[model samples]
Target: MQNIIEVKDLRKEFKSHSSRSGLKGAFRDLLTRNYKVIPAVNDISFTVTKGEMVGYIGENGAGKSTSIKMLTGILNPTSGSVIVNGMNPHKEREKFVRTIGVVFGQRSNLWWDIAVQESFRLLKKVYNVPDDVYKDHMNHVIESLDIAPLLDKPVRKLSLGQRMRCELAAALLHNPPLLFLDEPTIGLDVLVKLKIREFLKEMNKKYETTVLLTTHDLTDIEALCERVVMLDEGKIIYDGKLAKLRSNWGEGKQIEFQFADIHVKKETLDPLLADLDAAWTPGNQKNVWIANVRNDEHIISEVIGRVVASNKITDLKVHEISIEDIIRNIYEEGIING
Candidate 1:
């Protein structure tokens, strides 16, 4: 597949001023003028192929939004190059706008007082879409998103889920080949989220739309993205296939066991299970230990047997490590480990 978006050595920085505490300090600082340069995006580079769905993920303040802004031509990079569909985004912004669509979860693009269908018609005129093309695309999106019932509802009167469906329809009214989705499922209930995800999958298959999504929901990443790009402290910490990330960085399963009459002390068991790096915590009730095992299923069962021999065992439950937990661990441990 050919590359639709290419970002090279992108860098964006901001000069932040320091505030003084006391009146005297403030007066002196105003005269001296103290400021620090903060690098929000530092020499990061990546490519998105045509018709690929890529997940852009990171913790807060990790520069995800800044990078998206640069890609969408909303903000110019301090240094480096961005080419979207064979055009320089910053230099040919007018052409770029007609080629891509963007939706921000924190904001709305539709007219607040207008009906859902009214907003779509207005966008058709604004984008200068041909009447036949607009009708064809609108019918497809309306049926796919199941927003036919919502066409007459005012934007303010519709629920968040309804409004989001309308927003997606409005963004695609121009028939852009590329789409940028920023937390599209934010604040939506599970049922509504599932509906949105299904609609997006249909769109991808039908239009071959190349989508770049930024979301905190792991479920969204798991369901929609084939590859994930993780950023930390303004740099790419992990990139590649999602399965590879899980195999390499995803720790392992967590096993929790309960005993009827457990009386063993931590000092005694700690040395016994020295080979396995496990943390034991007492459960909410009595005679139970919740153990977190790291990539050693055999050792977990062995330890359980040993515990059973010494104490009366009741029940055991094992759970696979979730992607959310794996990413959280990566952030807590920092990007590199010795």
Candidate 2:
């Protein structure tokens, strides 16, 4: 596969000025100003191949937005290199933007006063899409996003969820091969998120669109991306398959056991799993027990066997450590390996 996005030691810096409160200090500051250089995106490098759905994630103020701006040609980097689709995003912004679509969760790309379909039509003309191509893309987007009814409604008149659906449709209407989504599913309900995720999956498969998704929602990353690039303090920390990340940092399993509507106290099960070293807790409902079991100390089967033999377990569930947990651990431990 060809590399659609390539970044190497790409760095971006911003200057800040400090002002004093007092009159003398303020007057002195005006004559000799103080400025500081802050690196929003400092020496980060990664690549996205054609059709690859990769997650670029980090905490707030971790440079995710700054990097996206640079990639989208909204901001120029202070140093190093960024070649996206065989063009410098900053220098060749006019041509580069036509090949990609961007969606920012907090911002509106569509005209607020215009109807949803009008916004899309404007986009088609802006991108100079052909009549047949625009019709096909619009049909697919409206169906996939379930926004056929929203087409006649003005953007300001729609609800957040409805507007989001329209936002996604407008971005994909031109069928840009590269998509940059910054928290596309933010503040959306579960059903709405599911719809968006499914639409993105189908779009990627049908069009081979390379996606670079950045979001604080780990579930979005888990649902759509097999590979993830974790960012922290403006640098790449972990870039690998999600499975491998789990193998390395997915230390424990969460096992839940539900009793058969009987009086099952914690003391009864303590004897059974005394040696399992499980940090057990009671579920919200009664007759249910949840525990985190270590893989290094005991085999999962043995642990389950110990509990099942003594207690009547009507239902049991075992889940591997989730990406959310793994990410929390990585950030806390400050694991830096790319």
Best by TM-score: 1
- Tens-digit lDDT string for candidate 1 (215-242): 9998999999989999888899887888
**Number of the predicted model whose lDDT against the real structure is largest:** 2
Clashes of 1: 0
What TM-score would every model get versus the actual structure?
Answer: 0.89, 0.86
* Local distance difference test, each candidate: 0.85, 0.89
Note the clash tally of each candidate.
Answer: 0, 0
For model 2, how does the per-residue alpha-carbon lDDT over 1-338 read when each residue is reduced to its tens digit? Answer: 79999999999999999787799989999799888899998898888999999999988888999999999999999998999999999999999999998899999999999898888888889999999988877887899899998889899999988998898888887888999999999999999999999999999999998999999898999899999998889888999998889889887888889988568888777777677667677876798888777875456788788878877788999987788878988999999993
Q: Clashing residue pairs in candidate 2, if any?
A: none
**Where does model 2 exceed 4 Å of error?**
19-24, 256-290, 296-317
